[model samples]
Target: MTSAILVSILMTLVAASTPILLAALGELVVEKSGVLNLGVEGMMLCGAVAGFAVAFSTGSTGLGLVAAAIAGIATAMVFAVLTLSLTANQVATGLALTIFGVGASSLIGAGFVGKTITRLGPVFPESLSGHPWLRAVFGHDIVVYLSLALVFGVGFFLRRTRAGLILRAVGENDASAHAIGYPVIAIRYGAIAFGGALAGLGGAYFSLALTPMWADRLTAGRGWIALALVVFAAWKPGRLLLGAYLFGAVMTLELQAKAAGVTWLAPELLATAPYLATIAVLTMMSLGRKTGRLDAPACLGKPFSAS
Candidate 1:
């Protein structure tokens, strides 16, 4: 019985972590291009509202997901225009973008408050659902499996692909990349938009699948945690998977502790576990003296302009 319970708990952790994994993976690519986007929270909020609205209106989860991606990409285009094309400060522009996303999402979601929509059902084969081991591993929604696939996909692309090499080169030194005839601005814009679309998809997962309910501020800073995970993982996709699962496990454990009537743990402290873990991982990364080597993009947060 104890073993069964433990397995169930682990399964729950995997499910809870999928959204964070998806969003973090997108942000990982964005930062890899030497662009620091702080507007993930905003983009996610927009996706949440947009996805919920579309799902409610059309009664189609597929269309809702597509709309969410479009909304996120549209919002990201604003950031791309300001930071990448106009050479505005990445940090300030990202923050402003996030602020806009938050307000816009809230106002748009006002009518959606307290609304519930039909959720996307689990995507596994019925045969697998009853098999104990397979159920534990494969019975989640399609998004969970896709998130895992993305982790490996991004890792391989960054390490092996020619396009990935060019992206990395651009992030490392845009001036040098530009001198070599690479389209630095175009690369950044595309990467930023891709990141935004992925983040939006993550948000839609919450509204259309996880909770299937609308609420203001529903993301609750998962975006910030995703940002931290990029740094904690040393900008590597494989490590991002580990970091996301670890945070997800911590979050699940907190909820379990609360449910099991663990009196010694304060509710507030339990809620802080994921954030605390992020801070700890970041501190360790910084203290380990890896910034000069396997750390952030060389030009991260720096505005790039063609001379």
Candidate 2:
């Protein structure tokens, strides 16, 4: 491929990777706080529709993102109330959340189908964003930069900060954390809220930044892939970046294949490339986990209460 073509592909890959990385980073925090929310896909859907509707109506991508985050937090509260307060089964509750998100989004977005809006433009001006070499550094929208920044932020928060240390304490042993007056349940609620908000933002990225349109199920199964990516990275932020880019490359390859109309592979198979890679990565991680090498949070998925 020519340099220009390569640059274009790289740009697409970055765009594709950002949402997954954003969603996975949020989930990493959720898991680290000892909660497993499977409703990420649903939350993303809520965010997608909410963001699109607001942005499309108000002519402000920024407002749409805000609406998406609220929608996500609202949806996540359902899971938090059930799993945290009522102590529902985490697995079952999570599955239900995903189902609810799918149906609710469809209902909410029924009228939004086929609608289009202006795509989010680059953050930098033409002088930088349009330059041959500098374009790679400045050619993307704000969300792209935000996603990269969050990676470093999360790594720092989880490893360097004292609050991060406390959150870890709760995840490692909720009872112990509570005994120390850390308010275990409260910290978890905050984590879940943060996760939901990020998932929402990630979902909004699909409609506002990537496609700049409204469509039901627009996020497809990327939320699930994000969930899988957390496992693939063993819950490390740095590795999460690597894994998101890897999947991004897979998605880019699929897009290139479809664009070229390559007859060597079936079109349907190309579409499944990202999911297939997710499954393969998950399988490898599972096998390695058989030796107890996995670094999962100790209290993950376990219901906790102050009582």
Candidate 3:
């Protein structure tokens, strides 16, 4: 491929990866706090539709993003209340949340179907953003850069900070953490809220940046991929970043194939590649887990009561 073509592909990969990376990072924190939320897909949908609605209605992508975050938080709180407060089954609750999200988004977004808006713009001025070679470094929008910054930020927060240590302690042994004066339940609530907010932003990236339009299930199943990415990265932020891009490359194969005018493979088959890759990657992770040190937080998905 020509250098220009390569640059274009690279840019596309970054944009494709940003939403998954954003959602995975939020989930990493949520899992680290001993909660396994499977409703990430639901949260993303809520964010996507809300973000699109606000942006289309107000003519402000920024406001749309804010709305998306709020929607995500609201949806996540439902899961939180069930799993954390009522001490409901985490797995079932998560599944229910996803169902609720689909219905809620469909109902709330019914009026927004088929609408379009201006796509999010690059943060840097055109001079830098449009530079032939420098575009690789400067061409992305604010959310793209924010996702990169969050990768390091999450890694730092999990590994280097006192609060991180405490969160880890909670994940490792919530009863102990609670006995030691840390508020296990409260910390978890904060973690869940944070994850929901990021998941919302990730969903917003789809409506406001990637497609710049409203569609039912606009996020598709990227949320599930984000969930797998957490395990694929062994819950490490750095690995999650790399994994997101790898999956992003897989996801963009359809576009690349069409661009190359390869007629042998059907576009439908190419479209399935990313989901197939997700299944394959997850299978490998499961098999590898049999031999490796268990990397999962011990208390993940377990309920805690102050009894």
Writing each residue's lDDT as its tens digit, candidate 3 over 72-94 gives: 99999999999888999999999
- Report the Cα RMSD per candidate: 1.5, 1.2, 1.3
Q: Relative to the true structure, how large is the alpha-carbon lDDT of every model?
A: 0.87, 0.91, 0.92
Model 3 weakest 10-residue run by lDDT: 285-294
Candidate 2, residue 221: lDDT: 90
RMSD of 2: 1.2
Model 2, C-alpha of 88: deviation from truth (Å): 0.8
Q: Which regions of candidate 2 deviate over 4 angstroms?
A: 288-290
Q: For residues 1-307, could you state the per-residue lDDT of candidate 1 as single tens digits?
A: 7766877887789877888888899999999888999999889889888999999989888889899889999999999999887888888998998899889999999999988888776677788865666678766777788889889998999999999999999899999999999999999998999899989988888888878888888888888888988988889999899999998998898889999988888888888888888889888888888336557889888888897
Model 2, residue 54: C-alpha shift (Å): 0.4
Ranking by lDDT: 3, 2, 1
lDDT of 1 at 53: 96
Per-residue lDDT, model 1, residue 237, is 95
Instruction: Give the C-alpha miss distance for residue 59 in model 1, angstroms.
Output: 1.3
Which prediction has the highest lDDT against the true structure?
A: 3
TM-score of each: 0.96, 0.97, 0.97
Model 2 residue pairs with clashes = none
